[model samples]
Target: MSLSIGLVVHASRRGVFEEAVESLSGISLKWVTYGHERDIRPLVRSLVDGHALDGLLVGAVPYRACRDVLPPRLPVAVPRSSALDLALALSQAQVRGWQPVPVSIDTFDHEVVAEVTEALHLDRTRVTCLPYDDDQSVDDICAFHQRSLKEGSGYVITARTAVLRQLRGALRVLNGSPVPSSIRSELHELVSRVRHERAGASGFAAGVFCVGRHGRPGDLERSRTGLLHLLRATPELTDAWIEDRGRRGVLVLGRRTLFERFSRNWLVVPVLDQARESLGVRVAAGFGVGPSARTSVVLAERAAVRAESENRPCGYLMEDSGLVVGPMGPGGPPRTGLHRDQDDRDRDQGDRLRELARTVGLSTATLSRLAAIEQDLAGRTVTPSELADAMAITDPSGRRLLRKLHAHGLASSEGSAQTHRKGRPTGLYRLAIDAALTGSADGHPLTAV
Candidate 1:
């Protein structure tokens, strides 16, 4: 019997949505359409009751909606095309004689490691997985370095390549040889591929929606601040934002270039789709990325919603029209998991802000408004207040939004210090005051890159 798969989608994106469904394997496809007004549970439950779902393809399902609708162990796919794209990239990389050296901060079983090595045909002697905690022993570092210098050791797949930099200085004193350049190249490429797979094919931007008790201090602010910091720290981010709507979480935006730059040693978190378990003050996060802004945003929203719905931590990838909401890491709370998706989204948004800041010399807030204005006006240069007005929010809201954007290094403000006739002075925010605008900071390779 053919495996049955169900799809949840919006009416507007039906065509492309169906195409994504057709791309999946191990199942015959079934589709269920939903709009902003309708409840999705009936459709989801109908599929589960009538068919053995090999997987599900979903649009952004709010957490409450998912808990009310979905059944346990319902294998769902999301933004299905992304999965196929990853599979293709992996195949191409293999054909090109690129061997993968998977690295995780957490340790995998020896059997699992052996199997991975055998499948990839890597030199088992060269494949070393050294798991380290914050308090790493010097002896462990020396031993790993010694082994890395031996012949056939082509790659060092560790969570953070930057961490290896400090170790390299230590190793040169303890052992003569350094990490092979080839290994470094391979490791870089592997990280690039994983990020590429996450973004799924074409260049695109994503938005994440977090809604709940915005007044509750720390949960929302801490999540947003930590995410922003993480993204900016990573080299790959292109752009990002947090909605000024006083919602539970921030909405992030960015492109694949940003993701590709920062795929090293990310902390993974879980998002759950069930509501039966909720720890007191437990926190969960959701993730979504794709080849387009709309899809990526939708997927991420669903993942977050799932985490909220089931009162559990969950992480998800879009597969066709379904979302693969997953359990947290081994020994993690079912209802509480860390989310890397938000971090990725934050990085992308940071990249966007940085780019804008480089060109205009503005803070992240100004850059964010500029981006929104750019899109809202269909790619036209816009005034800051004009941009704010276009967002349909209050002046105070605009100010707060701009402040947040400023934090991202995307925009700037200039105006008389005297208070305006109405009340507080509103500065004229613009793109960052960068050399690009002044023509002084040009031709620098660091700026160019």
Candidate 2:
């Protein structure tokens, strides 16, 4: 299939990205170019609404700016300013008869800056680093550089081209855009992901909808009928097969892709809100994935029950691979499970799972589910926010889960990472579950993984 990818780029860096024309083989391109960061939102909206795109490639600023408009399930890849980008910029600065020390940098991670400078044996104290964040603006970046200049910095390095353009004449600013090789690498990887997800879209999904509280049997019947009607009339769910589930609920059956488009990739379900407003009833919904109808129904019913317990009307999703995502109501909720759809593992591994689950005070099933997550992560470090996103949970819940895993010795901290230019760096951890799973569960130290 010919995949269409929408690339949201700042105009200044267009040349850099276009240099990778070789990566565009057999793919249709929809370039959304903006001169300033402020122009990103509208351009992204038009591209998303008008184009049939398989995936989106964006930068930190554009991703943060237009996140609300992008489809939740759309494959997105944000190529960060990697260490290689930093090292190249520093090398260029040195070749230009400039010193790396006392250099102010914006948008690159703090750890990245430290690594590059330390490797060059430069004075770390002289380097002023302002990390990248979604909420950071071009003005904010320029201010950091200006502040650094006032403090006697030799020059500034910026990953964002807007920052470079804004301060070019007044200051010695080096462009921090990734080279053609880096952009090409990112482009190829995004294409691979889009292809993989498109293939997985054939998976089956089931949705369960239940009314919250009702006054009488008559009211209950009326509410259930209303729920069924609302779901049927929803244009997004037109492809779904809807049926009466019970006295106060309905069942929806469809392909995983169909449901994802309807639920905004399960981040929010507008039909529930319609039921709340039109039918004057609260509807708690749940979605589940499986290879067969019966299994999907069972999982969907379980997810519905989980959603009903959330104090407010919400939605939850559970996959056969053991990932649970939801509380997808006014806002998303806690997530803690695997991400990809894995083939059912042999039951022979149950013994170790039970033992590890016992050690950590979680269910054997939950432990087994986490094992899938660990495998997906390979040996890479994870942050709470990233973990929460992987499991479809909230940030607060991710932090809490991080603390819990740390306390339980299931994860080991690899020190903290700076999330923004200010505030504390979020902790990074490695899942230590494998360590316990391999040996006697009695002695395995549980650290934040």
**Tens digits of per-residue lDDT for model 1, 302-322:** 766665665544333332323
What is residue 206's positional error in candidate 1, in angstroms?
A: 2.5
TM-score (all chains, Cα) for each model: 0.24, 0.53
Top TM-score model:
2
Off by over 4 Å in 2: 6-15, 19-21, 30-80, 94-99, 109-124, 131-147, 150-153, 160-173, 185-203, 209-239, 242-251, 257-285, 290-295, 308-314, 320-323, 329-449
lDDT leader: 2
Give the 10-residue window scoring lowest on summed lDDT in candidate 2: 339-348
Query: Backbone collision count in every prediction?
Result: 58, 12
Give stretches of model 1 more than 4 Å off.
1-199, 205-245, 257-283, 310-314, 319-325, 328-449
Give one digit per residue, the lDDT tens place, for model 2 in 210-242: 998779898999999988988898887898999
C-alpha lDDT of candidate 2 relative to the true structure: 0.74
lDDT of model 2 at position 36: 75
